[model samples]
Target: MLKKAILLIVLLNGLSPIWGQKYELKSIIFEGNNEISTSRLKGVTLSKESPMWFLQFLNSFSGLGAEAIYFDSSKILFDLAALEEYYRNYGYFEARFSYRYELDTSNFNANLIYTIIEGERSRFRSTFFYGLEGIPDQTYASLIQDYFNASNDWYNQATLEQNINNTINILLNSGYLNARFDSTIIFRDTSANSADLNIYISKGNRITVDTVIINKKGEGASLVNEELLRKITGIEQGSYYNQEEVKRSQIRLFRTGLFNSVIIIPEQNEVSANNVNLNLDGNIGYMHELSPEIIVNNQQSAFNIGLGANFIKKNFFGEARKLTLSTSFGIQDIFNVDFDNLIKRFSFRDTTLLGYVDARATIEQPFLFGKPIFGTWENYATIRKQKDYNITYYGSKITFEFELPKYTFVNFLSTYYNIEQTKEVYRTNNDSLASKLVSTIGVDLGKSTT
Candidate 1:
């Protein structure tokens, strides 16, 4: 009994170190996968290799960086199955996957390798679409020509599904709100290595906007006019219901800054309904805010620091109009002076002080003259105390903004007219002053996908 007990203790000691030691997954390698990329295969697997050595080294001390991925033996089985499934999705029905692992006991790291035997890949013999009879003739033709003209192409299930989704989106935007993917049929011939694909879509009754109901919430909601909100939403009562357009409308309302939260819900009583009612619920916050800002920038190759404040009024005078008043003062070349002397340089008598001051008042309206174009008017005054000269300017600007339809080359346009009067005084000869008046007009165009 004493000898047996000694042997058990010795065995426990020997296994303790191996059980507690951690083994990181150093790398994953794929071989014989010529048709598919190795990086793509890696994405489909559950096992993940550790980050680079330097990242892991830094992560050890901070515990917040990219940490090492420790090896898990149980995930290998799932990884093999995932790789095989991924191959089948790519039309490699006869593909086979096998794996082997190498463990470095000395460094406590592991390397996993996979070998893929990709057999004959299946090609598309015929593709067809069904139950698309009621759509517009142009739309139907576009769908068939763009998506289903895939005879003899490699049979890729991923690409096939993506095309189906895109087709459904076209239908949805065409006022078929209840349109959806129904089923997919695949007839495969193993001997010929070909497939016949069929996809069906169930497009319900085309829909139109019957009415729009506004529900206001939160404090100061009553300050926003429903008509102005409707104009900003861009959803009309008698227009065809479009899903993508509704999403865009919701985004526009959020951009107005009048609402803290915006939700536009399209509701239909039945699946086959022909009309949808849009319900717009908005949560409005305080109508006014006074906030301070600390500004830092490198302007004209010199670091500048400034302090500013703004007073904003939302839904000002109704109609979703906004008013903002702003002012700021900044000092240039801050780094060239000592901290103790920085505050002393603010005196107007100190010619060595290089600073600037600005003040502005701006008013913006969501729409102009009942049209979709946005408008803004601003008046500003600025004073700059330079080393050689001191200059002052008074200016006013009028700007008109237009949002163009999507898919166009230019999605946004802005045109402005600016007028300013400048007065300059030389520091060397304080009595010598120059005055000028300037006026300018400009337009800007931009494109955005989102």
Candidate 2:
């Protein structure tokens, strides 16, 4: 029996008016279901009650809530059949399903009620695996004892299917590139209310990489070299095939932001015995962009409006590097300020019409020293005038980030250093000026599963 079934229900919110139907399905209730929850049983059927009464009440005023479901006698048989099929998949082989409805003619609402007879559930009597030979003995044992341990539990098709996929992943990560799930057979004994499960898998010869072909598309492809992409992939000739590493490589390449699309295709058709060729295809987009925008901000409890522009150059210099430059200017307290002399007051020394001025430049390198580490450098300058203080600042920072392989205590690591100079002047005391230089260095390490 299939574990998951996609049930599509066509809602006829508009059909009631045409057919002059009066009863809207107000509630769906289940009774005598000892093993399965009512919510789960409802999820498997096409029949659904309308939204809650409060939601329907709110819908009358705002027109945004779950729509009403009119009673459809024609769908009762299909709903019951779906319920029976779901029960069988849950190992309730002798289950029975029946439904009744209560109609409130005065209110023009109907309540659907289902009765379930959950008979004896079948348990797994024995389970067997075939065709997982030639892999490590411990791996086979772990798959049996840990991954697919289905002891004393009712026969659940979904759990069995999920375990099969997990076992296949273990095989693929262990270099069995051609590993695949074949089929599962279940023998049910109605008299004993038990089942024997047989799962078959084909783990073909463990494969190694014979060669990797780098395929590029779009105009910006030449800006990044094949060597950098190959290093990013970490898949080399004569290396054992690992699906996890292949996925990680794809993620690394994508994190560069140089390519719009990336795909690592295993050339299994070109396999020779235990060796196969892989293809890494990347599609690049336009590498240069000049964007301008309007910035609205709340600074010092005042609403401010600004204009900004950014120029970005992708694949700058080489090796999938990126360069960005941006600048913005905004005025303070426009409601209380005079714009008649705005151009005359636009001076660094004049604080009358000044809000803030900020400019920044950044460069990003995908990798450093032929390693997985990523590096970034940024420099910025700013000037601001508020109700009490006026300030000017300039700063620069460099950061390096990288991710460790799996099974490590810390998977992500970052280190950065920043130095800045700031000068501030107070409005009340003209001579009260402060200037300082600050520096900081730190490291961050964390384990990430996403």
Candidate 3:
């Protein structure tokens, strides 16, 4: 069945045999490269997911996943350049790399061998900051301290770029909309392999927002209420031009599910002095998503088949609300593999009696009572046959989730369940109460946000 499944997918996927372009990678060997691992580089290289050794051996004799990975010399040059750029980003400025490939035309296979020589690395000597006369002395000092703390002995172009951006953001968030940085990298004692960084801070005039405009991509899409947008963004006229606040507003609004994409831009005022307004275009509206589920079991004891469907109504109420209707049915051990007559407890039932059915409806609301809290309510019913008894269950659950600091969430759930069983499916006379009422409460920590 595994072979048949693979063959079926391949035939339908339109895989054709093309000569001279089909060869699997034998091995990727690297020498004199020490800073980075081969596995990391291979992950970036063009290769399909690695199969087990047995699969490779099988492919050597037979054609299994034969078209998965084929060698193309055209991509090797780009990959080599990518490897060099990767090393340069890691402070290996003087790294030299070259590659050689050995291919066997008879067997249609190849081996890649790479040689590399990494030279001495450049380190930081001293950092000098200037032109910060406009910024408050205390603020400038704090920014410098933060840069030093974040660097912590690492001297690379990437780190310096990040440090500079962070410093600029600090000033921009502090209401300095026109702030700019004059920076340079001076190699200090190249023989000693040390570099000096000089960043001249120009904290331009502090500014304030003069206006706020809310515009939608479509003429009138009722995905989000205008009042709600104003409140959630927390941006208004006469407010400071705070970049952090703008970013937070973006996150908060995007979280609402009202927009598929969001971008907030600040436009400087041409006539008004030290004043700017914001322009944001949101791609808004609702979408209907259909998801399918499939499960297969070939094990003797658990010869089962399950099929399910989920119809999700995204933004059901013109907000970040979801209403989902789903159903699932499973055929469990229909063939009665374990034909145990002595111990019927462990025996499998007939095909009709071995099945289970489930149905459910759920609604999720991300913002409850105008707060950043998630709430969900679910109602469900299920029926299953075990041995000769028919068991039925009905339940409802209420869940509330809250977002916390550092990408963490806490969830609280309360459930009520009612279950009953009967020996005869058609008559209620043989029915017995399995459970009158079962209530449960659970608290989950570190839940996901999406």
Candidate 4:
């Protein structure tokens, strides 16, 4: 090993000479930053990066992934422009920036330092509303007064978009089916460095669904149940337009993982003149994937290797159920198989488990008993062998991966475990021991949830 290390060192040193070179970045330092931390600014800069300690040390041997990086002048200039733009967007228009560097000749590495000066933040001076003459008094009251929690802090662009969506929702639920927003208008106050915002609301004619259709696309694009789809939609011929219900129903449909795309389109009903028709059109594709896997793990005290294949079906039997099947052949501590030195020939043929074979299969139904509770029923079965110990493990489990209180999910499983042992050494019952079976069944409301 010593001779090999010397040879490796000679080969590395003899190839090239790297004594004096251009300055490369070793560290970056920031000063005068108060509101934002130095790390946040570094996140957006594409030029400089801080290397991890262990990776930097490893780079000394052979540089590889996630190793040290050097400084580039072009990237530094790009980062400067990006930082100024970031400050301007965050209401720091008068921000100032400068940088300097310190170099070390031993390794041709340098430390870069940046200085920041953040100025006063801009605020929204005034807000106004228009185009609400046709809306009801209560609707209008809900719109301008309590629709937003606009504090006296710095202006945020996200707040404006949220309020606009809120206005559209309110108008839709209040029988204004075709409500929309006009272009936002802003006026800046040059003297005080503040701005004014105006949002115009348009409430169009109220309408109801004249007809509803579920159009599926792609091969094998069948729903789990037509009745289930209709029930989830929760829209009827004479039902009033409710944007909240539409949004909620769409989310429930997407959670099933059955469709690749879902789109809700509403069109005017010219014949009826007052009602509109909606189409819930989506596409579901046939899915079948199989892949081979080889895994080897070597640790301080143990080694294990396995060869396996995984098979998956996204929609099982066209019912939106998912099935996963996997099988493996594993060997653990292959060099330490039980043996008798008297007979040098291997004893693997005498039921002395030199290796083990394992297989597992599981299937999951996302919606339990066809309900919108965001729950699933999963069944799993697996078998393993401990050849050297003269024992085998066989087990099957039924699990309920379901939503708990207020939209949280938990996994609860019940398993039946069986063990088989070779009777050459001792005599014992072949019967297996498992979780106690409860044959009788009854509904327990407190223990069960939708």
lDDT of 1: 0.85
Q: Provide C-alpha RMSD values for all models, in order.
A: 7.1, 9.2, 15.4, 14.8
Predicted structure 3, TM vs. truth = 0.53
Q: Summarize candidate 1's per-residue lDDT along 41-72 as a digit string, tens digits.
A: 88999999899988878888987669889888
lDDT for each residue of candidate 3 in 253-370, tens digit (9 for 90 to 100): 7865567788789998888768888877687755666889996775447788889999887666654677899999877775754545424544333434366789999888766777
Model 4, position 228: C-alpha lDDT score: 55
Can you write out model 2's per-residue Cα lDDT over 364-413, one digit (the tens) per residue?
Answer: 98778877778999999998887678899999999999868775688889
Cα lDDT computed for each candidate against the true fold: 0.85, 0.83, 0.69, 0.63
TM-score per candidate? 0.74, 0.75, 0.53, 0.48
Model 3 residue 315 distance off true place after TM-score fit, in angstroms: 5.6
Off by over 4 Å in 4: 1-126, 132-148, 156-179, 185-196, 206-212, 222-225, 232-262, 270-276, 287-319, 323-329, 333-363, 368-370, 381-450
lDDT of 3: 0.69
**Models sorted by lDDT, best on top:** 1, 2, 3, 4
Better of 2 and 3 by lDDT: 2
Give the runs in model 2 whose Cα sits over 4 Å from its true position: 1-29, 46-77, 91-114, 119-127, 137-156, 187-196, 269-273, 297-303, 334-349, 405-412, 429-431, 435-450
TM-score of 4: 0.48
Worst 10 residues of 3 by lDDT: 415-424
- For model 3, what is the error of residue 359's alpha carbon versus the real structure, in angstroms, after optimal superposition? 3.4
Instruction: Supply candidate 1's per-residue lDDT for 199.
Output: 84
In candidate 4, the residue pairs with backbone N, CA or C atoms under 3 Å apart (3 or more residues apart, or in different chains) clash, namely none
